[model samples]
Target chain A: MLKDMKELFKEQWEHHNLIFRMAKFEVKGMYQIHYLGSIWQFINPIIQVGIYFVVFGIGLRGGRPIDGDIPFLLWLLMGLIPWFFISPTMVQGSNSIYQKVNLVSKMNFPVSLLPTIRIVGNSFQFLALLVVLFIITLLYGIFPSVQLLQLPYYLLSMYMFLFAFTIWSSTIATLIRDYQNLLQSMMRMILYLSPILWDPMGDRVPDWLGNILKLNPFYYIIEGIRSSFLGGDWFFEDPIYLLYFWTLTFIMLYFGSRMHFRFRKDFVDYL
Target chain B: MAKVEFKNVSKVYDMYAKQSDKLLDLLSIRSKKSTKQFWALRDISFEVNDGETIGIVGLNGSGKSTISNILAQVIQPSSGEVTINGVTSLIAISAGLNNNLNGYENIDLKCMMHGLTVEEIEAVKPSIIDFADIGEHINQPVKNYSSGMRSRLGFAIAVHTDPDILIIDEALSVGDSTFANKCLLKMEEFKQQGKTIFFISHSAKQMKTFCDRVLWVHYGRLKNFGAKKRVLGNYVEFTEWFDQLSEEEKKKYKQNMLRKQYTVQEKTKRKQADKKNKWTAFGHLAMFIPLLVLGALIVLGY
Candidate 1:
């Protein structure tokens, strides 16, 4: 299992150029038919944030601030930005292998890079949204401080978690397409379950229940991103969650790679 | 040096009644199911030296494409082994071109996937375009191109990559005679450069003109692999004879061959399975134990 993971890592390292080039093309290809081309990448997410802001911040929360002085829109945007990246990436990355297998089957290309390509492709939009979030934070008078340096750490954490989940999910989805549908519904459930729309750290939710929900690795990411921007505890302060997240990610990576290498040559047969 | 060798290589494709059964079989959760195995290639062995252009001639359903796919490393053999010494590129009809991408983008995409640097791709880009000869259609999406144009671009890209082993699987059948002749000249140049090529085509006369040897496959088995004249002569005569048989007789002949392909390996496979049963039980435990522990951890709030 370790050997398989190492082999996949080596292949990814060797073909990193191909992965990046294909990712760039993927982002370009996404909106090639639209009149605005790539500009929709920004517009679509902003529209989603607007909808959630109205529904959750105004309609539900009475346009009130989250926690103390953090306006609901700013707080929601922080969590939703990463959620927007994570959600579509979950669907697209899971489908990447099944979609590209036929196109690349005749070549000697590394199949493991397909999921990575999706993850990286989706990151372009995620990074753009992060820039918007930063400028919004300044507009709201939240000055850049030492807490902002942790943004990179949280960003890396998000990528690692996405990589692990996508690799594993893509393998299962390719083998059993029903899993893809199941994953779609599960992402919807996760959106509600995570502290994205509502505050699990608020007064209404029970402490034990909130702790249970925090067990989700995505909670670590959504919360980590919010905390980095909103000035909360560092990731290291939550040692148990940090340990749990890394453990889960590595386990997924190990198994994902094992299954990936075992069935790569047979992927064409399946399709 | 022998650039390609196959030692008793065979490929078995299992026909699963339900897709879920495939997942179960992959995970070894189910010991056996009512699976039907189709042996595409059975115990076939051959070797090719550098610079040798071997023609693969077989009737439809004789597993000709299966052999080419295995040779190109697109699929793995079910048993035995194959050794390929250098980079391989396969050019089937419209193989590996993204339909949504334009012709020029397909060139860069394929070349990049083959590990060429950007500068290298740029250097070869013009020649590939010139050779494809699709003109202004190069800017149009590949989906809009005709089959002939698609194959033209496919052949152009495959040759430009300059693989050490090239397998052409009926890619020439879809192109115009002029383009086919152009490909043949380029293949002749490759032969002079000591590259091994596997040519699979129905045109016996072309095979005779170009190939150093011919491999005649009959229903997944190697009927003969020898000098060009001898094997092609035998194959041409066999096809002529088979073509003259009554329709019923032809049906009977095919049924008999396919039955043999299915049943020949059953006894050996069973014996091997019996031997494997013991280790498989232990293997199940090894996998199950870790999964059980992992489940416990997840349930315990990680």
Candidate 2:
């Protein structure tokens, strides 16, 4: 059943320059037109956190401690940063092929790179959010630590995780369009399920349910971020979750890419 | 000497009478004969020597553009092999230009697509801008440019890349006569450089002036491909005859083209089917080994 994916990788290698340029173009073109331009990168996420805070932090929890000792805003912001990064990143990453049908069909560039372009595009925006996240943490009196370097390690993990997910989501979303809507609804559900707004690890959430929430591969990312930011634990401290996340991600990525190779030629017709 | 060759290259689009047939096809449950097929091209075989200029002439939906697309490697042929010897570029109105990007950015984008390095793109940028001749508007978004200006930019970027085989599909139709002539002069320079040029156009005069040979396609079949005078002469005669046909006769003419066209050639069908099955059956797991390889690499620090 196995084809020479080494060949597929070589093909991707050949188009690395194209992917890099397209990703760079996407990152630049996104914020170039507006008056606030690059400033919106900072404003958009802050406002998103504000709305979540008003609704969940203040409205629901009355702006109190969320984790055992962490304030609601700190907990919420750490969770929300990844949430914001992932929600649109997946949504847009899934739709990247449908949106750039012209480029995929008409140009000589690699169609597989479409998902990567989206992932990279969102990563740049996430970079901005990352800087803001650190700033807010610093303001709250958490001094920088040796563990701060873990941010890049987690960033690489998020990229690997999302890029892998995107390989599947973008390709599958093209074949079965309902996957996009399904994902949209699922993202909403994921928000509730993944401890974005609530204390899934706290006593309010049952121990069994909280343990189950950790099963979500997406939780792997947010938990990694929180662990790094809070200096609670190293990524390898939880080896089972790491293994589970990698297995789930690579399998989805494998299937996602298979769909890409099989259907890439037919995409223009489908569009 | 064969810069490009198509040996029995055919493209058959699976025409689903009902949209749900696509799903059935996916499940491999649909009977072979139950699915209607529309062949965009059939048994197309030709070879273009280095520096040869070939013109493609056909009515709308007659597969002229399809030929250009296949040769440019934009799409794969359904069955048979396409051997292209060198870098190919296709120029058409808005073929690959991103609407959101400015003209200047589009040059870099297109050049990058051609796999040029940063220094290479920098070296060619000035020439492309000069060739396009769109002044201050170059800084503005391409979506704001008119159709004529878009073609100018597309043509400029394509020709500047020094492609070994250049295919132009109806892009010149939009530009003004002066710009079209300017393009022709540039193409002549490419011809002198021993590059293969495929020109697809409705203009007989343009074909006569630019093309050394002509290929006439009719209803997805190659009617004739030879010296421009020999093929264009017959194609002109056929169109003239068609124009004079009475309304009743025209309907019969179309019917005649479709008659005896559905007989499935087992060889081409089997090849396409085998390819489809191979990819669908194990295509996912095909990458299983690669994933394991990547997994191993990731577990390692680097």
Candidate 3:
């Protein structure tokens, strides 16, 4: 099993260019279905941001800033953008194996590329939204800070974390048909717990509870982005969260990989 | 001497009552309810050397497709192993073409997947285009293409990629006569280039025209695998003898060849045990409600 996992990694490495191009095609394929096409990528996120800002920012919080002086919209977006990237990647990546079956079943390609293609496809959209993030920050009168340089690192780590969950969910979802539905509902709940709408750093949350919530792997990525936007602590300032997050992420990654290797041969039978 | 080899490979698929049965069987360390195991191919072994043209011939439901699918690595064997010396390209009816993408883009996409670079694909694109001869429709989505056009495009991409082994299964028959002639010439060229080919067809004429050796598979077993004349001779004799058998005799012959995995008595025993197991499960849940009620009554001083 260990050797097989190593072979998988090697195959993935050797086919990195092919995976990247296929991801480009996948993203193209997604927009190809829509009449408005690639414009919807921006429009859909804008609409999501609009509804979220109105609901949580105006209706619930009375348009008041959740994090002191950081506008509710900016704070919400810092969380929402990452949430947007993570949620879709997880959902779509889980379905990637089934969705790409036609493209792959006839030809020879690295099957590992299927899940990662979702990630790569989503990353292009995520980068586009990052531009929206900067535009949103500028509107809030927040100047670009040097801490923003660490954005790529946070993006990398966050994708790694989500990619682990994505492949894990994809593999398990194939075995148990209900797992896909379960993940859909779970992602909805996770959105609330992820400190997106509510600020964990605020006085509203108890320090002990807030500290535990910070231990959530999503919170680490969200807070990292927040720190970049609001110009707060550098990511590594608190090394324990970084260490804790990596430890959890690595365990999940290994477990996810093991599940993929075991179930991969049996996928045709199940499908 | 062997470019492709199978060492006693057998693929047994578990025929389940439902999808959940598979899940249950996987979860349980020891299954209480047995699954019916159907051996798609049983203890089959064969070898084909470089530059050989082998035809797989069999009657319907004789595991010919299963063997080809295994060779193409679409499905794996339940036991034993398959060793292929070099890359094998499978060109079937579907041939893994993404329907959403245009024919031209798909060519690049599939070639890239096969580890060809842009330069390599560009070098081969004109010939694939020439062979397929679909003209401006090459830019159209593959879904829009006719089955013949799809096969043409698939064949064009597959043969042009320069694979060491080629497996073609009933795919080329969909095209027009002209395209079929073109494909035949291309296949002849491949043979001249000394590549191994596994061609499967129902028509004995095609087999006789192309194959250096013929494998006659009957009911998942290799009835014969030898040179063109011998296996074909045996297959002809078998068919003649089978044709002579009466209706009842033929049915019995089939049943004997493909035996039932479980007897009727064993099936009924399993059904009875399943009923008992379900009762115990319901009993556990049914007992829980009253036990909870009794505990509640005691706690409330009833």
Best by TM-score: 1
* Candidate structures ordered by DockQ, highest first: 1, 2, 3
lDDT of 1 by residue, B1-302 (tens): 57899999998987677777778877766556356778889999998898899999999989999999999888889998899999999899856687767888888888888878899999999999999999999998888999899989989998999799999999998988999999999999999998999999999998999999999999999999999999999999999999999999999999999986774223123334565777856664575455445444544545
lDDT of 3 by residue, A1-271 (tens): 2565577568778888887888888777667657898998889888998998898889988988865577888888889988888998898889888666545654577677788878888889888888888997998788988998888888888987877777777888777878889889988998988889888667767666676566567988998988887778998886656666776665566667877888777777677
Full-model lDDT for every candidate:
0.86, 0.80, 0.81
Model 2 stretches with alpha carbons more than 4 Å out: A1-17, A104-108, B31-33, B259-302
Clashes in model 2: which pairs?
Answer: A2-B286, A3-B286
Residue-level error in angstroms, candidate 1, position B295: 12
- Per-model TM-score on C-alpha atoms: 0.92, 0.90, 0.87
A-chain TM-score in candidate 2? 0.91
Tens digit per residue, CA lDDT, model 2, B1-302: 68889999998877666777776676566655555577889999998898999999998878888898888776789998999998888887765687778988989887887777899999999999999999999999888998888889989988988788899999899999999999999999999988899999989989998899999999999899999999988988988999999999998988788763454433233335677777766765664665455444433422
Residue A46 of model 3, lDDT score: 85
What shift in Å separates residue B56 of candidate 2 from its native position after superposition?
A: 0.6
Candidate that would win on DockQ = 1
User: So what's the TM-score on candidate 2?
Assistant: 0.90
Please report, as a value between 0 and 1, the fraction of native contacts recovered by candidate 3. Answer: 0.28
For each candidate in turn, give its C-alpha RMSD to the true structure in angstroms: 3.5, 4.8, 8.2
lDDT of 1: 0.86
